[model samples]
Target: MADQRLERLIRQLQRHTVVGLDTAVFIYHFEAHPRYLPLTRVALSRIQQGHQQGVTSTITLMELTVRPCQLGRRAVAYHYEALLVNFPNLLLVEIDRSVARRGAQLRARFRVRPAEALQVAAALTHGASAFLTNDHGLARLNPIIDIIQLDD
Candidate 1:
């Protein structure tokens, strides 16, 4: 069953040349969440292997580092920052004016959080064909960009 799920995820990921990774995906991988780590591992491996390109908003860095910083795990936070910045075939997209405008529209229409909207906006603006996330609310964005839910 695990192998089947992993294979299915790989197939889904292969369908997209560029995939946008959400912050939750990274958190799962970082924490090695038992249920979702396999999925995130496959997704990230595809990017690391150069089979597909990965994109994520800079907001992800902030999200990933906050808890660690709060817990006084500065070293861990720095490690995550370094990994994110230097990850292979992954682009950390900056939030710009165009992204901000699109994010505002998504936020208003979809009623998602500001960071979530900006992440999707960055993905769309940067030519991502699919966005990988665990947040079910983001599934509403399928019409805009394919939303690949980890659990599904």
Candidate 2:
């Protein structure tokens, strides 16, 4: 069943040229979260192989590094930073004015948090046709960009 689900996810991802990734997806993948690892592994592999372009906001970088930094795991934090910076076909986007404006609009319209709104805004700004996330609440953004929830 897991394999079948992963296959379905791959198919869905293959249909898009670019996919937006949320921070939770990376955390699950890095930490090897049992339920989500398979989904994130396949999705990240596709992005790494350049089969799909991947995008995420700088907020993801900030979010990913905080726990490690707080725990005095600077090496681990550096590793993550390097991985994100050098990852192939993955663009770590900065929060620019346009993205901020769009994010504000999304936050107002969807009542999502600022960070969540910025993440979606970055993806949409960068032309991502699909956003891969573990947050089910983000499914509300399906009208603007296809939201692929890992749990689904």
Alpha-carbon RMSD to native, per candidate: 1.0, 0.9
- Quote each prediction's TM-score: 0.96, 0.97
lDDT of 2: 0.93
Residue lDDT tens for model 1, 31-113: 99999999999899899999999999999999999999999999999999999999999999999999999999999988999
What would you estimate as the lDDT of candidate 1?
0.93
For candidate 2, which ten residues in a row score worst on lDDT? Answer: 143-152
Model 2 stretches astray by more than 4 angstroms: none
Model 1 lDDT at residue 91? 95
Which pairs of residues collide in candidate 2? none
Tens digits of per-residue lDDT for model 2 on 78-147? 9999989998999999999999999999999988889999999999999999999888898888888999
TM-score of 2: 0.97
